[model samples]
Target: MQPLADRLRPRTLDEVAGQQHLIGASGVLRKIVESGVIPNMVFYGPPGIGKTTVANIISQVTSRRLYRLNGTTASIGDVKAIVDELDTFLTPDGALLYLDEIQYFNKKQQQTLLSHMENGKLTLIASTTENPYFYIYPAVLSRLTVFEFKPLKKEDVESVVLRAFDTLRGESGESFVLEQGVAGYLAAACAGDVRKAVGAAELAWLTCPPEDGQRRITLAACEAVAQRSSMRYDRDGDSHFDLLSALHKSIRGSDPDAAVHYLARLLLADDLPSVCRRLLAIASEDVGLAWPQAVSIVKSCVDSALQLGMPEARLPLTEAALLLATAPKSNSALMAIERAIADIQAGRIGDVPDHLKDGHYAGAEKLGHAVGYRYPHDFEHHYTPQQYLPDELKGAHYYDYGPNKFEQANKNYWDEIKKKHR
Candidate 1:
């Protein structure tokens, strides 16, 4: 049996669901189709947003001989064979070559397409979930325009549900009445993914028992089959933004347990890279100089993830999250830099004192550069109050050390130095 997604696959641009930004009137794609001019391009986005479907539609609309290949399995020889076949079918006429998961193609395999794209022999339309700018070859990327397809919206998912339910009804002869909440429940579970929504609807049908040979699909029935409570976390909506906000706040609030909990949820849902990146920001933004080690630890987790990948790599992330949550919290460093930026933008610029200016440049000595600069090592405690900040910020204090052992000791040491210098 054909999968629900496959059965309802869009045969034309009109039937295609979602990605109104790309297919709407006056959209780049719509314009291209209308003008009968298709360019070599890359569709960079997440899974199941119609990259393949769009490619197929373009071929049909343009009446071009389309050759589709999976980048993961196709070899250089296979690509060459297709190119040879394409040559015979053309006399200055163009063809569309669709490559799925283009990132799976290593640099050597990618090089095979550079000449073809450059010479305008084929209109290459490639799709990749990974960032093509990082994964694709520079030469190949340079020859293609990149279009980003955003995840489908909830409304789009709902539209798909309505269509699927209608189709099911037609086939089953009203055997099932799709309850009002059933459509909403399935749509939410799909998470801005039309494919998943269709799959959930099919599951609901299979699980519901026939009433007089007519099955009635309800919210509970869908939930039982899908094994998901609700689709409240719309990947492309406000809930998505809200989850990230809560995750950041949970860390900043200094609850290690809560931090770990949120981190676990995100990781379990496969948002590790984003979690790692956000932790890096939190280290400097929330922990700052209060615990300088936090930044390095977060960075280490990121590197570790890149090295070990998933499942095994989650340990480093867990360690980093716990360290950040327990670390002394302060926004002093974040604030201080922001204040400095404001000063600069407000044109409160001050001249560099002669002693602090670079002495390695020509005629620096005559210019009084490095004139009165004192070596802190020459003094006891390796401390000196020689001016470092500009005059406007000379006595301004930024970091107020927290109650942590290391910060306390450093604070005492700096306090004694300030007294001696005064």
Candidate 2:
């Protein structure tokens, strides 16, 4: 028997539930599908959310040839073989090559696609349950636009559940009774996974046989099935990113309570590494220079989490997140480096001054390298001043001190030193 998910697969963009941001009246994907001109892009989100289904629908709607290659099951050789055959295909209108779980393709395997995506033998419509930017080769990612799929809102899931009810009646040709709140309960339990939602409804049917009257589906029946399923996390879904953002921002915003709440969400999903990695970043980007010790503390917590492993790992992870949340916040260090790097990249400055160049080489003094260099220790306050920036950017200031104790103190000292030098 076909799975309820496949049976209820949406044939048109309008038939697709949720993703209003993508398939709504003004959605980018809706426009692409309607225009009958689709580009190579990846549908990125958690599983059972219509990445593959959307790809299939696009091909059918546009009447385009489709070539599917499973990244996990298909070898590099298999991909090449398909592409080679496709190069000589009779279809004038190019095909849509649907690669499911494209994250499984390693760098070497994905490298093969650089040519096809460039030459356009086919339009690539890849689907992934992992973040494409992290798992996919940069070359592959560069060639394809990423369309993020967010989790379905509750009302959206309820609408799908209501539709599934109709589909079941037509399929079974029997009167089915959906008890009050049963559909909503199922929808809520599935966590935006339509397959789970539809399947649970189907599973509930098996629990109670058809009688002379309507076979009513109840929340109790659905709850038994929900027990086997885990949390509603699509690790690659936008919710994952959203919750992480919430956690980071909460910590940076100085609310440890909100930070811990978001951290708990990831812990339930067993995504501690992502949390830890974010904590480390928050330590630098948000807490930066203000505490200065936050980076080391987060790093230790990462080690402890890995060594201790999960459940228990949540402890150190929580500590790390809280530490970041409570730490003094400043971006002076991060912003300063960013501006300096930008300057170098834009070629906004000349070569290092002669005084700043390496002068401890043969005959270097004769060429006046380090000619006017002043050792800071050779003067009062051990802070003799001289031009350190490139000749074209002399006295250029990059580091702007925020009004934080750590940075403000340093700024005052620099100001005083500059006064003495002047």
Candidate 3:
């Protein structure tokens, strides 16, 4: 009942498609296996990116005894049973206990491993999709070196997909025809998850009835299968955050093409609300003052989107995204507000000048509130120098406007006014 991904799992270290950083010849694992003394470690990363495969490869190459457990289901009793079994073996490096989703282990179950790990009964290889610091117990973490497994690259996924077909042909003597670029399409669509890529390919394979005694898979077939999988828009998952991030960064970096690409991805995810919110923030925080009108444009786009919904709404959104991507970018306003906030948080406080205090209240005249106020309308150019900040930050400079043509006039006006004060 093993899936195609598991069945086609790489057997040797050299066979792993990606993860060259950790499993290459000069990798830490290689050094450990070469030394014949494997230690406890944790492999942290997203799923289907070869955590279990890497662990299996390490155990085989190092000739260490291997025991596998799932954190969600494994218990203290299971740990005891495995340790008890391994206790009878006189292996020098002890057995390797591979626990998937190690974050699911409760403190009590994890506690059972403390003595076993310390005594060399098991060299633990724990894996988790969540952050290890937040999920793994400090005691268990202290004994394991953490290694991160990145999602496999597009080429890696393609290689895995192609290899599966190779195995199918070798076993059945039937050639599976992969339409040109179908492998790449599946690879890219899986978001670097090799296992997901294989599953998609498998679905496409199963859906295709053989023509002339050979199966042919195309992008359309893979997409048809992907419709029922995670390729659908996940509004609250990692991909949601990733697409929003990509869109923001692309606009900030002045890449209209990339910004539009990420926008399309968000639309594919069907997360219109999140897209609108992120666009609004980007217009203000990123495109602030540079293209002050960007705020209105993006807001109009969002308003139209909410009113009309998708497909039709994508037009205005695209226009706003393109406008932001091509606009000169700055964050001076955001930085200025944050700096002011920090000053307040650091206990910066000052009494308002009598002239600036609330003088509209009863007895305000006796308190000298507004007594010495200098009306700016009475001064030349209807402008007068005044201290608006708290006493401690009277002349603090926060805004650093970039080379934006739209803000140049504002910056020049300040430059002349500040000169008068100087």
Candidate 4:
């Protein structure tokens, strides 16, 4: 039997669950599809996000010969067979091939399509759940334009679930009772995968018990079908880094609640190392010299998290997040280093002052190394103003006092000392 998802697969761009940026009116993809000249394109994104559906829509609108291949099983021989069909009367106008999971194809397999693509014998629309640039052969990837398909929103998934429900009802010719919020529950549980949402709705309906001569689709039934909320996280994909960014930004923004929420999401995805690393970085990058001790405290929390692992680890990780979010935030250190590095990169690195060079070596003092170097410790208040920066970067200020109590206090102390000494 055709699965409900396949049966209800969108026949037009308008019916696709998400990715309006690509297929909506005024979208570049819509313009391309309507132009009747399809190029070799790669659809990049997670599964159940309408890559195949968009490819199908393109095929329908262009009235081109359509061929489908799964990278998991399609061999070079299969590709050769398709190539051999190019000259046949059936595909005189060239063929449109939809290659799903293109990342699974080996380099050689990917290269096999290059000649056809180069000569306009075939227009390829390949899709992959992984980052295509990382997986596709450079030669093959260079020739294909890439478009990203994002996950469906909750409302979009709910719409799909309700549509499937309506279809099932029409097919069964029976009045089914759908409990309030059941559709939304299934939609949220599917984690933006429309295919999963539809399948769960079908399962819920199939397993639903008939009460009073009607199969009541209840929230409990939907939950049973969904099993558990699926996390939209992939260690190698964008979601992983996106969640990490969310956590970092939340902590930097001083929202402990949001910080913990994002932290929980990462932990639920079993991304302990990523969270720990980001937290450690946040200590120095965001908290910086404002709360110098924050680095040590976060480090301890990270250590405890690594040793504890998972369920127990979440506790330390949570503590670390709370500490960071509530701590005084500053990026002065980060800005200082970045500015210095930018100067170095731009060829602003003048020779180190002779006074700052290694003077402990024999003959170094004779060579003017450390010749004029003043021992600040020998001066009053252990202070001396001397040339430290390179000649090219004289008087350049890198470090800025951050606007925090700790930094401001230290800044005031240094200001007084420098004022008296100079």
Point out the higher-scoring one by lDDT: 1 or 2: 2
Instruction: Return the candidate ranking by TM-score, descending.
Output: 4, 3, 2, 1
After superposition on all CA atoms, how large is the RMSD of candidate 2?
A: 5.7
lDDT of 3 by residue, 53-92 (tens): 8788778765667788999898888888877776465555
Of the candidates numbered 3 and 4, which has the greater TM-score value? 4
Residue-level lDDT tens digits of model 4 in 15-83: 887788988898999999989889999999878888888888888866568899999999999999999
State which candidate, 1 or 4, has the greater lDDT. 4
**How does residue 126 of candidate 3 score in lDDT?**
90
Q: How close is every model to the real structure, measured as TM-score? A: 0.66, 0.69, 0.84, 0.87
Where is model 1 more than 4 Å wrong at Cα?
A: 90-92, 228-264, 270-281, 290-422
Write down the lDDT of every candidate, Cα atoms only. Answer: 0.79, 0.83, 0.82, 0.90
Worst-scoring 10-residue span by lDDT in model 2: 86-95
Tell me how far the alpha carbon of residue 386 in candidate 4 is from the true structure, in angstroms, after superposition: 2.8
Error of 2 at 388 (Å): 11
lDDT rank order = 4, 2, 3, 1
RMSD per model, one decimal: 9.3, 5.7, 3.5, 2.9
Model 2 residue 227 CA deviation in Å: 4.1
Predicted structure 2, TM vs. truth:
0.69
Clashing pairs in 1: 175-215, 188-231
